[model samples]
Target chain A: MNLRIKLIPYERLKREDAKKLVKDLKEGTIILVDAKLDPKEEADLIEETMKVVSTKFSGIELSSMELSELKETTNFERFKNMVIERIMGKKRGLTIIGPAKIIRKIEKNPEELLLYM
Target chain B: MVVKHFRRLKNRLASAIRKVFKKKKEIKIGLYGPVNSGKTTLANRICVDWLGEELGKVTSIPHETREIQMKEKVTIKDNGRSLTFNLVDTPGIATKIDFEDFLKFGMKRKEAKERAKEATRGVIESIKWLDKMDMVLVVLDSTRSPINQVNITILGNLDARNIPLLIVSNKVDLKSSSTSRVRTAFPGYDVIGISAKTGAMVNELYKMVLKKI
Candidate 1:
């Protein structure tokens, strides 16, 4: 099986609906988002994934890591990052979404994410 | 700005009035978390502590509790202060439920498929029931990393809905369990470490629950 990984900007992701993401996932393509999705967006994605679960398409394995959450920073730096995230409408990080059938699990650590197939 | 302030005040006043007149019997405290996070164990502990019975069956398999189970009129007394409310044990939430995963646990192929299908529906029902909870206990396995999408999403949805919540870092009896890790993952929430299986520090959890409600 040919493995396909699609890199999607967070802006484009926000512009497009989660259905599009789920569609890519259904086709067995791994998706990499430029920014970590907020909790609501993640929840929305899970809901969308659940709607499309079938025998072939089980669901999605999603994991995200925020840059700000990785390292300890001063209060000022934290505030600055927050301001930037608010202005940009997404956190500075990386998110990986893949079909659960393909990727068995996404092990997450404080600093990194490991995808196991 | 004045209108905004007035609206805030009005909302506060209305909320206060509602709290004053609200019936205690209607209060629903929900147990929510990812799959295999020991939510059922916690529920059973709470039930046996207050109601002299267990709420549901617990197992090593994921998605064991595929439906919402509720026990009413559970009253907990702490320091001479008693509180009573309905306890709701919800099915564990997961982003995926592949039938093949269950086959590894010695389940038959047909039974695995059925369990997977029911598990998917259970996830949907759990999410749908979130809005009905007066308060939620987000149970997390302390032995596992707490930064997963399910944990983040659960915490986020609760925050979005303005629902009061407490993070229950369960399985403290395990050597790998670390409540500090859970705290580090989620810094601003109320976190309590407990061993639901062993009934360790559960009284502290009860006190925290009473304080939250």
Candidate 2:
């Protein structure tokens, strides 16, 4: 299976982006959300991403959780924009959303996620 | 009531015996890193220390070993600590694999595309086998910037799994090599500097592995 990973920023999470996201999920393209582009709190990221990915696509739920966390960061050189993530009391990393079937399969056995690669 | 207690005691005793025996099993120590980070070279260094032979081919070209390579039953003993493991040298991990990236090395378009495909698949296989590893050596080019996405992603995956890892800051023979930079980037992990090609500090790594394990 061909996997298309879309790295959409938080600012561009508009209606057209939502359409493209749902369309890609239907076709099994992996969506990676980098919230640093717009800088939001962790709760807000979950809310907005869930709103776009969950209700529109029936039977598909957004498995939004803290997959990664920034326990400590001494500087803000590499991730300049994402520094706001720390300021907003949120961590930084990609929020992955995908087709319900694919997400289900990965959750059932994360070992099987390699199959898409 | 005493009979029921005896049955439960028996089950716990059996489980304890299984755990003690299982710890003696050989660990799978995977060599994981970005492309051309000297994973194969380090694997060869350890293999030569015990087996008197090298592991795989090394080249300046990226993705040279686009598959999993293993040497089994390599045991290292130092100062009462010993680690017997299967040394797995895996192809490097990259966030993106493109045929155009390979073309820079002066390869034909067809071969480059084929190499790119195999390299991408190799990355997936490397990740799939991550769960099987008892330990991992995250090799890095010491001179380069340690804040790249590839390094962070690799570390994040390992951290998620709670896998034990040692960061190898290799190629220290070069003028620009800075093991301290890599250490600063990853504060807590054990970052060792070495010239894998020259076997410098390789023995120290073996002893360190036993300590870490």
Every model's DockQ: 0.56, 0.05
Residue-wise lDDT of candidate 2 within A26-93, one digit each (tens)?
56666766532221122222223333332223222232223223434323433663565568544444
lDDT of 1 by residue, A1-117 (tens): 999999999999998998888999999999999998877788778878887787799999999888776667666777798899999888999999999889989888777899999
Candidate 2: misplaced stretches above 4 Å?
A: A1-117, B1-21
**DockQ of predicted candidate 1:** 0.56
Give the least accurate 10-residue stretch of model 2 chain B, judged by summed lDDT: B1-10
In model 2, the Cα lDDT at residue B131 comes to 73
- Count of backbone clashes, every candidate in sequence: 0, 0
lDDT of 2 by residue, B1-109 (tens): 3423544354345435634766877778999988899999998988998999989999899889889999999999998877688999998875445566678999998
